[model samples]
Target: MYMALIELKDVSKLYGFGDATSVALEEVNLAIEQGECVAVMGPSGSGKSTLMNIIGLLDRPTHGDYYLSGKHVSRLGANQRARTRRDRIGFIFQSFNLLPRLTALENVALPLLYKGRSPAKRTRKAWDMLERVGLGDRVFYYPRQLSGGQTQSVAIARALVNDPQLIIADEPTGSLDSNSSRLVMELLSEIHKTGNTVVFVTHNPELTRYATRVVYMQDGAIKYDEQTKLGEVGRYARQVMYAVPETTEEDDLAGVSAIMPVLDKRGVAADKKTKLPRRKSTSHKKRKVLKK
Candidate 1:
């Protein structure tokens, strides 16, 4: 098995010329392993979107070789690039990108249609993808009839309809509320779990919790990132603002004991984190109510 499913060798993407010329990507080099789930974080005009386009095979670099599964693809002709993308890459976007007039199944089937698949085959594959995303019952529902979460699910189905080995997602949860965002984010994680390489782009700090490794960008260049586990973020959530005290088995037990009433008999929180306990106000005793 090759180490890198995708590789960018000193790639540079430039736009304009003369005084107006700008280098969006400047000699960027990186490798993405198979089945890895990563997030690219950057501000607008940081070139993260441009990098995503290049990685998705929707754009080309001005200089250097871009390889997919070890095959250099920068010089590939338009037809060749299209074929490669269709065969091995999938894309998810913030907008969901579903054809509003079409049913969820039809929207998912659109990619297969581009592949010239038979009607029966495309329908079967589309329904299967929909079911995989837990949207079987909504197969006939149109995008307008579905919730934000459901719409993104249909978009995911479309991306996977062709069984692409690589999935590129850009701000996938951008438009959703917390509930919808969690559902869509978890769904994407499951997709990565099933052995497809996933490259996600976002600026949300909390979203980085799900990334195996994060890529931070500024001025079209990578800054700093670190490997992480979202599962570990629970007890460490406050660590971002304050240092984490040394934790021991006893300390954990004590913390759990303090939180016991919050958790029901099943060990699940009954209140679902509506409010947190806070330190007592030091000024409480000094204050007296004035009754006029």
Candidate 2:
């Protein structure tokens, strides 16, 4: 059986109380296995961000059980949740959330400071992560000095610097232009290839082409969930063609071949591709720290 990296059972989130209450999520159940790249798409007010926040441990479900790598965390106290967020999850935001005063390296290293790493060690690891994200030369550059894409890349490096098992990205490409969006998507694909579970919220259906599974939400509940053969050029081509307005048959056919070549005649199956190696769980450490 595949080990689930994230499991939400009848999860719900609400704002306010009694009649004034607003339901942001309604008994949502989801299981994301290790190494799966899941795209969560929905219209505004459909609870995509709420779900991301809940899953990222930034907020607790109003009611339900949340298991992250088999540990029940839905009821964890604020400090415990914060530690879990720091130790086990990496978050990417559409705004690229870098500290304006900090250079790329400093921003990336910020997370490690809480872990009590020496400054030199933090710098070394942050620098290595920046290099991994193709921003090694931009280490000393401030956010103001970077393009939108570069800023997002730095954010990604910061997210990965802690080597978190799960990456939660909220509309990561929403603010980028077409080319930058494509670049960010490609980078996300590379991250998924490294056996990390990635769950992202996106409005752009085109971006779902890169996902192994797509979850659609409506009215604060899951509307559809389906797995697809990613890495199949035809799949993305078909999605793009459908999204384009008033394309002719000739254009559709030509677009398919020109867009992205099929990497595998038989696309890698999710079951096979996502059989990630098990890692030690840090729940105990987090709990101990929280108890202190």
Candidate 3:
């Protein structure tokens, strides 16, 4: 494999200090090669999203070094990092972070504007990107006017409009219904086939099977990084029985046990809606902690 476009070497990110500190990641090393799609799977609070944010330049680590596209960014200042972000990285989220008022074309054009591109050229490029994502006819629609799948398509177009070297996605499908999720995954697979590096953090292994490589995570570290290649010829069929018992539990989540990484926010609501027994929601208010 080629030298990673994003390399994490013995990275560590800690919150708070010795007496009250929590380790998010510890000596975690990873290399994401160009043109490969690697899925990071873990549950809420497992530091998987922490790794994603660090890799995406949204946050920094407490220790260790990181090299993105050959530049050591661990020690870079905020401005330098911001410029690097605008120039090299593209992000997609499960929530479909599209501006509510901007049409699909305008939404896609926003990133190029930050890069100092002129309106005329950026619009043309954005229109092309929308068409590429199969949203040509919907370019004039606002976010609320589009379906969940279409909104995600717009978000994907926005992420690609800048032509960044790496696409960092966190739970890109966690917001959609099953059908919408399938469509988004198919679109993502097509985008990967177009030759660009992708590192997506998701809890969905059904989608991970489409990745060229899989990075299974647990307790904030990669447990199994295996090569995965599924046929694109047809979909994976699910056998179901209507008479089957309905329950809140499924074996799929067993894979994510004890890993609590990020909320995978889009799915958080649906998961709550399922009427399953789950942990009670907690407010942002922090409780007082006395010294041990």
Q: Which 10-residue span in candidate 2 carries the lowest summed lDDT?
A: 268-277
Per-residue lDDT of candidate 3, residues 1-292 (tens digit)? 3457889999999999879999888888998878988877766667888898999898998999999877799989999989888888888998898999899999999999888999899999999999988899999999999999999989999998888888888989878776777777777777788888888876643455457777766667776676755431101100011101122345533433433233343333333232211122322122001100
lDDT to native, each model: 0.74, 0.78, 0.73
**Index of the highest-TM-score prediction:** 2
Candidate 3 steric clashes:
8
Candidate 2 on 131-188: residue-level lDDT in tens?
9888989999999999999999999999998999999999998788766777787888
Q: How accurate is candidate 2 locally (lDDT)?
A: 0.78
Order the candidate numbers by lDDT, best to worst: 2, 1, 3
RMSD of 3: 10.9
TM-score of predicted structure 3: 0.79
Lowest summed-lDDT stretch of 10 residues in model 1? 283-292
Top lDDT: which candidate number? 2
